[model samples]
Target chain A: MADGVAAHSERKKTGNVVEIGFTGDDAALVRALENGHPGAPAALFDRHAPHVRRMLVRLLGHDQELADLLHEVFARALKNIAQLREPARLRQWLVGVAVHTARGHIRARTRRRWLRLASDETMPEPAAPGIDPAAVEAMRCTYAVLQKLPADQRIAFALRFIAGLELKDVAEAAGVSLATIKRRLARAEKRFVALARREPPLEPWLAASTRWRDLRDDDDGGDGGEAAR
Target chain B: MTGGLQALGRVAGETAEAVAEPRAEREIAAARERLVGAREGTVALGRELATSQDQLLAYPGDDTLARARQRLLAGRRRAAGLPGFVRLAVPLAVCLLIAVAIIFGLRAREPQRAATATAVSYLVGTRAGTLGERVSAFAPRLGAAPAPELRFSDGSTVDLERASSARVTALDARGAEVDLERGAARVFVNPRRITRWTLHAGPFTVHVVGTRFRLAWDASTKRFSLQMTKGKVRVEGPTIGERQLVAGQRLDVDLSQRVSRAQTAAAKAQPSARPLAAQGASGRRHRRPVRPARQRLARTTRARRFERVEPMPAATPAPAPATATPAPAPAPARPTTLARALQHVGAGRFCQANGLLDDKALSATLAKAPAKALLALGDAARYCSAQQRARTIYLALWRRFARSPSAAAAALALARLSHTKGASALQLQQAERWLQRVSAANGASAAQQRIAAARRVELAFARRQTRRACALAREFLARWSAGSAARYVKQVAVRCKLTPERKRR
Candidate 1:
């Protein structure tokens, strides 16, 4: 994947035969889409679809339904492209749509309580042999607890903590006010902490919550990629 | 603990990427090919699905394929048949656009209904300091009998009577304020969409709600009189008290006890109380409207009812603080949780401020508080080390009330937060954007704008754009000179050696 991305080194000059990724600011691509340029939508799919897919999958852990959700997300995006008043916020908007889609998945799971959810069987493939077992178990334990949360709370928690969206963006994606998002977060955090306490595999994480700010990785500037001027 | 949460999220994200995301990519590729193929006349849209039990065993998405197939079949049938939804796609899309155009088009014209009235933007004097320079306050000398006309952007007029002068102290999206010094002033606040226009006349404050009124202060007589010939005005003063006067009514300031109506204003004031048209007013230059006419009345233009002299008044008359918690009445039933938090923030009692703000009850006001309240909340969150919350609240205040002074302050706060620790190039650019917003705000104080400009020089220095930094530092130092911002900018220039030590003799 790194090599694939490396092949496209930021489109140095205009009118070059750019690769799958448009390698230009989102605004230019949006303008092309508005003009009905055929390649622009494909470029948008290549640029944003990966991130959108990643966000939805992370929020709705190991769901086979991801493909349907993916089609719905892009179909809706294509249909509503012009509805976006600010094209510069394309990434945020796409991620918002993914989060909304994830919420729908969670709601469905909530309603289908009787369906035997194939949980642990579908966890991601194991890391290389040298990887820490505790970290692997921590990941498993984290999802185990997340599956219990209400849809709104789970979405808020995922967007706020997992995706690391700013509170404003999270509130926007969830279509709720900032205060309401905070309220939801407070409840979710409280429940998550209470649940994590019972899982011994998550003991370190539970303890780390007390000093989470101290141990977190340095913010080498979040992927807050530049917006169009 | 926050770090732990972040770690958990990283692990969760990576795991999902390793499993679900890969699956997602493969599926999307498959779906895209089918959809695009159907559109481009390549492969047939979709193949028939197997039985449900076979589908469950063979593929993860038999249902999704069925749905897509049905859609494709519908499209194919439409293409071959007389008419269908797909056949009508172009016309349907055009109709949708036309409907959207109609909705927003009507919305575009909504402001013009208010356009029938005009509001003052600038009060220019014939001999004013510099003609056409936008200044916050205008104090014009009484040169002629009519004095100089207050010329709004729309070219509407107001005149300070002879021997009278007024200084416009502040003008904001909400309203305008002018300090009436020493004599009477005839104000023609043309039917304005803005809710409030206030003139601080001597001992009294005359609040105009889109009306023509005359407020006279007899300095020698030590008396103030408010005559409302059109619309209504609420007058408040120390001894004169507060009184609401409607059209055809007059209130006289009796230094003895309270504001009292002297008499019903006679018919003489009513007939002549006509709203002054730009063309009718004498000596008024009828310049073309400064802004496009259609764009003129787009802003909310809500006449914010006079929010008493002091913002955040302590005494809210509501007896029950619990039931009415949602509304942060301009006044509060109790010493506001926000006010107390602000005090705590000032006193550096960060824990207490944080505690107060974190209360479940206080969250109600967090959403709807005025810009000033939001500022204090942002400050409290910042001091408590809740950087994310602080940034969110500051950004909200900046976005919702961009025309207020608090918004500019929020911009500066966000800029400062951005550069806190090893800020990235993108973060620095974001800071630059915030500073630009501050410098651009018409409502921001001169001091705040100057500080923001100086900070930009500092950002340049931090980015190692030494040449640019030095030049900006020199410019900043020259402009700010003795101001608080000058010292840092001067140091930056001197350190960068952009400004050399005095040439050796």
Candidate 2:
């Protein structure tokens, strides 16, 4: 699993050579995309796809159709490149597109559930050969709880906690004001905690986490974080 | 926690070299600290999930990006193949469909009843909800940050400011009646052919027919205040009965003190009023020194409908060696100067008032004089069209008493005077700086703060700082989305082309 993840980074380092690399800043890339330059799409993908993919995986969990969803996100971005309001903020805009894509997929899955066609377990497992079982179970349990949340709240929570984006970035990705995102994250956190408590597999982790948090609180004398900002 | 857990899990089996986010763990740890006081189980949940960030963020394979790029470029190729008109067809058809629906909907909907009055009130600012939500009559409209506004169907609006509460008591075709139970509310009644709106605050009743005013009632102190910004209204209350307030006038009724003062622009004389002793029937500026007897008479008759003259004890026996009364009075030199300035201003002799409140005397008394006196002198300068003198006095007031309750008013006055017609860019910039001062004033009135915020947006837009204007407009809309000026702010937002997130970003 480490090799696979590390290999992805390695491939990018080498892939820059084989591909006719079109290197530019975000604004230049946006111009390229808008101009329909032949290599713009690949250049954009190679530059931004990793962050978008990470955001999507955090937002939607480990789904089998992740690749297709990633494709759809870039496709939408490529199609609407000219509509990007601030070319300087292309990364944030792309993250927004990914969040939107994940939200749509979550809604579609929910609709499928309403029609009795799919379940949460229906997502095929990713083929990470040497991943730890505990890590895998934690991921599964976390996303299972996320499944019960509203799509918007889930996006906010996943982008904030799982992807470790700043609050403003999370808000940007969710296409909401920072205050609105805070409110949604607040609701999502409460709901996620409640749902996670119902899952027995997460009990030990929750207990350990509580103990760790208490110790950290005592150690730091309890000040707030960049989250508030 | 995420990094720590990843390391622990690595010790359990997986390698530690591929820990994706070491710095992210620090941030997550800080974020989890905010969840410490959250509801039970929430902190633990945030902690557990935050610790699993590495597991959750799976790096995508090279094939994914390659495949996505191919599809994206292919899609772009297909889109290019389509004709330009065909590209516009879908949106045009949808717009046409919406237009037809709107037309049919309007035709099918019953016409609004002329005898019925309707209003929708919504909260704005940090806790803002939908921009427009219908509020039933008699339902109390509560204020929040920045304020809550009740928008009437007739384009009128009532903004509840500073923890205020109000409700519509009676609504009808002629207009609606709003009762301010407590706190302050700024009302703007749209001008109509037969507009009739009445506002009740405590024992005071303000009868309106196409006007804009701010009415406040403090039940604890039994104080009722009205500041008429535009048009006119008739206020009936204790101490002041049926007082007519025109544009740029303010009335404050204090039941505690049994005094009601009406502050006017002091430039216009009341209709059918007796002429001032100095200024004859010709309405010409007069320079004759007014006698004490006629000054008293002028204050009595002129203040009856215009301003309430509160005589300062220091103004008495100014430089007069009187043998009748012998009380140790602090040197009456500067105090008498300020008093005479106020007396001239109260008597509607603004030019005389400005002449008395010169730069040297004003500076000498700026610290000792009460903020109210300085404000009065400044207003007199403004009314007298002495913009430079008014600017000096207002700027001094703001600088000397920056923390006083009157500082915000002084700043606001300075801003308005500096940004007057034909103001240079430098003056406009100075006006913007003064507006920022008002906004930053700790003890500033909510109304003043709201006005400053709105003006800041407009000033920025006028100065071609579209980005700042858009940012300020978005902030103003966030807090005062249901406000009277929200439409203009939204227009500014549209002109700047800022999306909500991007604007905030």
Candidate 3:
């Protein structure tokens, strides 16, 4: 379905399907989904899958299970839509659910890695097909730095920098107070920048923060899609 | 955080998505197709949940009540979306129904099991209407109508006749102590495992270990009766004092102050009272004091011999002195070999029992002995696989004492022998009849009914009666999960397979 819409977008040379947001009010859409209208969840999926998938990929870094994660996120949303009190913030609530799911996956993976330490093997870094070697090395070093950080810090840094979410949005997704996110980000940024300084491939990224921020704004429309900042 | 990976992502993030691969697209497409094709989402959720998903994504759709709540939530959402006036009317209707339900629910009180504790109100073989007292309480009162029955967890059952009531004051591994308030009850105690039981029936208290017997008490009439169908019971009361009631003997307590003679099938049979005792296969001794006998009533008319009927109240104020027929006094207990043998068998010392019965000194005693000695000898011989001896003993007991409890057991034993090689169809028919009558056998005589039931199922299966065998097998499993023939029953069930053709009722 995502491919169908991407293909359609290609034919038209227009934006992705998510850009054509469902027209109904969030409250009405939630009620319709709760009512088991069938079409409502499909519409919700169409409206949110690309956004959720994009955010998950950014946070997890080339997550191979992006498809399953997207299904899980939307299935949860569809299931719990009735419990959503603030219909106007449906997108924000969805982000909270997605953050929880991602954290669980991270924790489970950490446990698995700990259990399998006798094998003395880690998952090999995914081989990208056509990416620049320099950019790939920098990205690889970024994940390595993130891996050393606690789960909360990793999530805060991914949301604030990789996904380009504001500090308030980061707090919302992490289901924590704004103060907590601020503290996490402050602590994470100090560790992240210090760690990045040790990686030779990330030297260029630290030197051009302003230019990089500009590139991010040009690519993203302040929502989940391919983003730069 | 932003200055580190955030800056790095701002620097190199574009590369990850820039190289979006075919495999990733294919993976995403597979998930999308599954999501699209999912019809029963709850079923998919159930299947998915076995692999521990995060709590946030896990749905509680598996539980019936939870699914109901989901449907209710959807209904509520739909109702909320309706116009304000419509929503107002729905809540009012719901409130009225709730009020009505509470009102009606209070009027029809239901027996509620104490879920948190084993202190529950359990009624079986009868209903609440049959009870003379309240059925449900923090502590339940179990009662029954004529021939009231009580079932214990260890597969032993008790039946009370003529409007009986009893309270299980305490229950534990040693078995239970029942305080029978009134009337009569026969206990079909499980003898396979040793268990001590005491019955407090009015003035008389009967103590027993693993046995079958009947005890009855009437406060108004000052009448107490104790009959040991199998095993031994010691009865204690004011009138009868303390005397052990052996198998095939009836001790009755009348209005008279002194103990009377216990009724026996053979007039010349010796009176034997032996406390129940057993030695384990390892030669370990176990003993439980038996209840004393109340002595038997005088011989009545042949028509009313088995059943004891209450005399109609005298209508006239002045009545002539009752013409009581005096029976000959009972002979003193003789320490004969035959009496000792019967006592040994009743106490489960079967080797000594059979050995004594084998002696030439007791040959004359066995020839004309009562049902007590006959049943004991039959049991002793049968235990030792002396089929010919058992048949002779059981046949005599069955013929001379048809109404006695021993007769039923003897007939069933004969039924077993009748199934032997080269048996006539008439003999098999007689065995089947005995098995069926085992169902009708009341109180103490019904001890072997469970084994008889299992044997019936085994017989059906052996005869290749597929449908009948399947039905009996199913019934047997439901009735007794681990009955005597549980392995045979399970085998029959597997053989039958509950096929649609077999289940064509």
For this target, which candidate reaches the highest TM-score against the unseen true structure?
2
Residue B416, model 2, lDDT = 70
Q: Write the per-residue lDDT of candidate 1 for residues A1-229, one digit (tens) a residue.
A: 3332333324433477543334456766666666655455566766776567656745664455655676667666766788777889998888877777678766765643433332334345234332245544555666678888888888877677655455777788888998788778766656665666677876654443332212222122222111100
The lDDT values for all models are: 0.55, 0.61, 0.52
Q: Give the C-alpha miss distance for residue B497 in model 3, angstroms.
A: 73
Give the least accurate 10-residue stretch of model 2 chain B, judged by summed lDDT. Answer: B311-320
Q: Please write out the lDDT profile of model 1 over residues B1-505, one tens digit for every residue.
A: 3333333334333333433333444443343334333321001100101011111222343244344333432322212321354446646767989999999998787556444444336746654323223222223335523356676553334566545556776554434667766556677776544455677765467777688877776543335677776888887654334568888877665321112234575643553222222112222333423443223211101101111221111111111122222333432423477666655544445456667765453545555677666776676566456778778878888877876677888888888667543468899999888888886544677766776777787678668777888888787777778643565466566646722221110
Tens-place lDDT per residue, model 2, B131-208, is: 223222222335413445776767788877645667676555667677776667778999886577888786567889
Off by over 4 Å in 2: A1-21, A120-124, A211-229, B1-62, B76-505
Assess the local accuracy of residue B166 in candidate 1 as a C-alpha lDDT between 0 and 100.
Answer: 63
- Model 3 C-alpha lDDT per residue in residues B1-505, reported as the tens digit of each score: 2234343333222322332332344343343234224312111221111111111112232132233233432433212223465457557867989999997785453222111223212244555222223222111125523344666766677775544456665554545567665556678767533366677665456878778987766543345667778988777543344668778887765431222447754532543422111011111222322322211112222112221221111000110111321211211333466656655554445556677654454455445676655665675676455768778877776777775566666766777666532346776667666656555433224335555665566455435467787888788778777633555467656655633332341
* DockQ comparisons of all candidates to the true complex: 0.04, 0.10, 0.03
For candidate 2, the chain B TM-score comes to 0.34
Off by over 4 Å in 3: A1-23, A117-130, A207-229, B1-505
The CAPRI-style docking tier of model 1 reads: incorrect
Error of 1 at B360 (Å): 96
Off by over 4 Å in 1: A1-23, A115-131, A211-229, B1-505
Model 1: how far is B17 from its true place, Å?
12
Pick by DockQ: 2 or 3, better one: 2
